[model samples]
Target: MEEMSTILSDLDEIKSALKKSVTKSDLTDIVKSIVKEMLEENKKEMETRVKEIEDVYMRKCGDLQDKIDGLGLEMESLRELNAKKDTAIRNLNATLDDAMRIANEARSRSNYNEQYSRKNNIKIFGLKESNGENVSSEVCKMLKSPAKVELKEEEILAAHRLPSKFTNAPRPVILKVKNTDIKSRVMKQRAQVKSAGIRISHDVTLLNTRLVQRLSNHENVSQVWYYNGSVFAKLVDSDARIKFDITDDVDLKIRKKLRHPST
Candidate 1:
């Protein structure tokens, strides 16, 4: 009975030690469960923060794209406006060119009419003028003596002394003949009359007069004269005669002639 009691006491001691170990293992499992729950909660919070940041970034990108699209539209509108302005400028230039052409045509026609009206007139220079003298009788006497041409009083349609720029010099005379044929005959004897210190020329337009003077002053030209209301130029060392009108480009024509004499 004593031995049996001692064995039972030993078994009781082993039971107490096993119970202590079970209690410690249960505490370790509880700690591990708590740590896992904490980690899950933290992970959820971080994911939420990341999602919010992504939403904000997407909104900013959309706004920037909208602004870029708006700028593109504005730039396209500006390009169209510029194109329209350029077209309008071209149209205005064309209209201005047409107006200038019409103006030039009208001016040319008016000049032609003015030149045609003075066709049958002649001017006499270096003729003596007296205040009360019969101008027609004096003209007849002068033409008969120096020019060797007889003219009836009726052949001269009109005669008058032009205003003199020099007070002491003789005034020039402008005369209208009955016909162009009679005027031609009188012109034929102008060289003979010029030998007696007289000068005769056609009453040409002012533009033609300037052209004649310009041609006379040119080094390339030998003589400039008028015949049948047209101005002509004789080139130096050339028999080629150039007939010029008021509308001609005289300098360009002369240059062309000098470069290509055959033309």
Candidate 2:
């Protein structure tokens, strides 16, 4: 009877344990909890990966921005240097212009001085050279034969034939008259002497020759000639003398109406 009672008590305890331990609702709840834990772990892992990506991209973006800033600084430096170079080039150009202006002024003064030195000289061609001949006597005799040169031999300061390397071309005679009146007289009789093939001209500078030729091409310039190594111009109907200056471009039309009575 005692053994039967003990066995019956253990069976009852076993039944109670089974009834409390394994309900279907509790089983479902446990599975749900396990799944929720796994999902939370997966979400944490994904967030870590996302943070890593963000960090990598942020570093790259920072590098790119730094490069852009460095390039901006370099560009600014280059612009400043280019501006300085432009200023330097402009200064050099201005200095060169000043140098050229100074050079031109010096050349003009030199040419003017040369022209001034030869003011009292005259050149005559077609007079043949003779050995040991008195040039003044020859000139006076030649002047009297066809047309009288109003100047006396005593009034001649000096007369000589120009030295030449070429023999075929006749050497011209250069004469310096003593008095201004005699020199004027000789020059005024140039037309009379020219009829006999005598060429009388002022000992003009090379510049004057070119200048006279340039002015003679103009329609308003009737007579273009040199006197006293300087170039002179005459209007078509006027006798007023115009000094042809190469430095200043004076229009001939303005001087055309300025007619001085014939001297």
Best by TM-score: 1
Any idea how many clashes model 1 has?
0
Clash pairs for candidate 1 = none
Task: Highest lDDT: give the candidate number.
Answer: 1
Off by over 4 Å in 2: 1-75, 163-166, 217-223, 227-243, 248-263
- The collision pairs in model 2 are none
Q: CA shift at 32, candidate 1, in angstroms?
A: 21
lDDT of 1 by residue, 1-263 (tens): 99999999988999988887778679889988899899899999999999999999989999999999999999999999999999999999898988877776776667667767766678999888777988788888888999889977799999889887888878988888888888888889999889989898888877777888888888899988887767899889988999877666778888899888998
The true-versus-predicted C-alpha distance at residue 177 of model 1, in Å, is 0.5
Worst 10 residues of 1 by lDDT: 103-112
Query: What TM-score number comes out for model 1?
Result: 0.66
| Model 2 lDDT per residue over 1-263, tens place | 89999999999999999998989999899999999999999999999999999999999999999999999999999999999999999999999999877876776677788777666677889876678888888888878877776568878888998887778877889988875577677788888889888888877767667777778887777888765646778777776777766554646433444542432
Error of 1 at 51 (Å): 13
